[model samples]
Target: MSWRQARTAHVTMTFDPEGLTPTQREGDACVACHKKWPRPRIRIGRLPDDTTLFACPECADALLPQQDDTHSLPWRVAFS
Candidate 1:
């Protein structure tokens, strides 16, 4: 599949509300760091009830899988 197709096919994981705060649960805070200011704009995941979970750009990058880098070596590196 192509990069565009892969990206469009990407599926975000569901978040459990039990571990999240009220703000996070309400989508007012960043799901990863709880940063309230600037408002988390990236949709990282969703709650059990399908409520979208937001994250800052930095945190979203950390949470989501990295896109295949064309300049990188053919062999991909996986960081845990």
Candidate 2:
């Protein structure tokens, strides 16, 4: 029903001609909130695939798992 504030920034709804909008369809655009970050962050799932699921900025970042981190554990163990 309201937009979430992110990093002191406000997010408002601006309808797109592409028709890609938030999955929420009950109130004033956003279902719960919006976000602003010091770094680049976006909700990947909110691209209007028509799915109610979403990966928040944090979740999206985690999902993108650091390329180096994935191999760090294996290098430490030196498995044959």
Candidate 3:
């Protein structure tokens, strides 16, 4: 995908409601950090297995693998 398409896809994926209810968003712990954020909100995404995960931006950065660099690497290097 082009940069614009990649960026758009990232935005769409990152903005998913994290499969949360209003009450859950308010009270649920981040799947990574295990803490509920107050202001703004946590981002939600799914695993390859279609299991949902929630994370704060900080935790997300640490929890999610780096797609940008991975995409640019050879398949072997990307996996290694």
Candidate 4:
């Protein structure tokens, strides 16, 4: 599939939390690698409970679409 399709697929997907640790379920760790030191901040998905899942930059890059600045407006500008 193309990158756009892959990104769109992930955007609407929610992850199951049954297999995750407490830290991961709480968003204190990387959902993909379980790394907690730097703290994962990228929103990757959500649990059934609606808790947000996170991942580090490296893992997020692998999981989500790369931001295209040329075709997209920055959030502030877009919102304004």
Candidate 5:
């Protein structure tokens, strides 16, 4: 399946290997498409109220903005 523009910029994926388990399964459905996902890479999005929602890779990619300028923002400023 092809990925589309993002729905929002609050989406993210976890990379913590310690948090994963062989028997662990993702029971949450994609917030955008409402489809069940079994894959280990779960997508999470933050709501307006700060609540986290899970989505599939397709949905996450589809929901992300195509050209967001905020990505250029600096995390820290260099002292002069």
Candidate 6:
């Protein structure tokens, strides 16, 4: 499979209806969990318009979409 850049991992947070901030802040919780069992490297999967950093190797591997599983190798794309 060719590993092209892709974004994965949906941040789980509940929003406060009255405010702009999230009611449930899980960023720290997530990072802390990752830090406890840190991997050798944090893989970042880049998308056509953005970049995303995944905490686990498993997460990195799961970054690619099911539809594009065949083209998961390293390929270059000029995404600005």
Best by lDDT: 1
**Number of clashes in every candidate structure?**
0, 2, 0, 0, 5, 5
RMSD of each: 7.8, 13.1, 9.4, 6.1, 10.9, 9.3
Error of 2 at 5 (Å): 23
lDDT of 2 at 3: 22
TM-scores of all models? 0.72, 0.20, 0.37, 0.67, 0.39, 0.25
Worst 10 residues of 2 by lDDT: 1-10
lDDT tens string, model 5, 2-77?
Answer: 2223433443533332343322323355665656546314445444444455657776566554555454444365
Candidate 5 RMSD computed on C-alpha atoms after optimal superposition onto the true structure? 10.9
- lDDT string for model 3 (1-80, tens) is 21232222244243244555544344355655556654324445544445444566676556445556535667697588
Off by over 4 Å in 3: 1-27, 39-51, 69-80
For model 3, where is the 10-residue window of minimal lDDT?
Answer: 1-10
lDDT of 1 by residue, 15-71 (tens): 889999999999999999999999988877888898988898889778887776765
Q: Which of the two, 1 or 3, has more TM-score?
A: 1
Off by over 4 Å in 5: 1-27, 39-44, 67-80
lDDT of each: 0.78, 0.33, 0.48, 0.77, 0.46, 0.33
- What local lDDT does model 5 show for residue 31? 61
- Candidate 6 per-residue lDDT, tens place, 1-80, comes to 33323333233222232321121122211121344244314433322233222335454445433445444444355332
- Candidate 4, residue 62: CA error in Å? 0.6
The lDDT of model 2 is 0.33
TM-score, structure 2 vs. true: 0.20
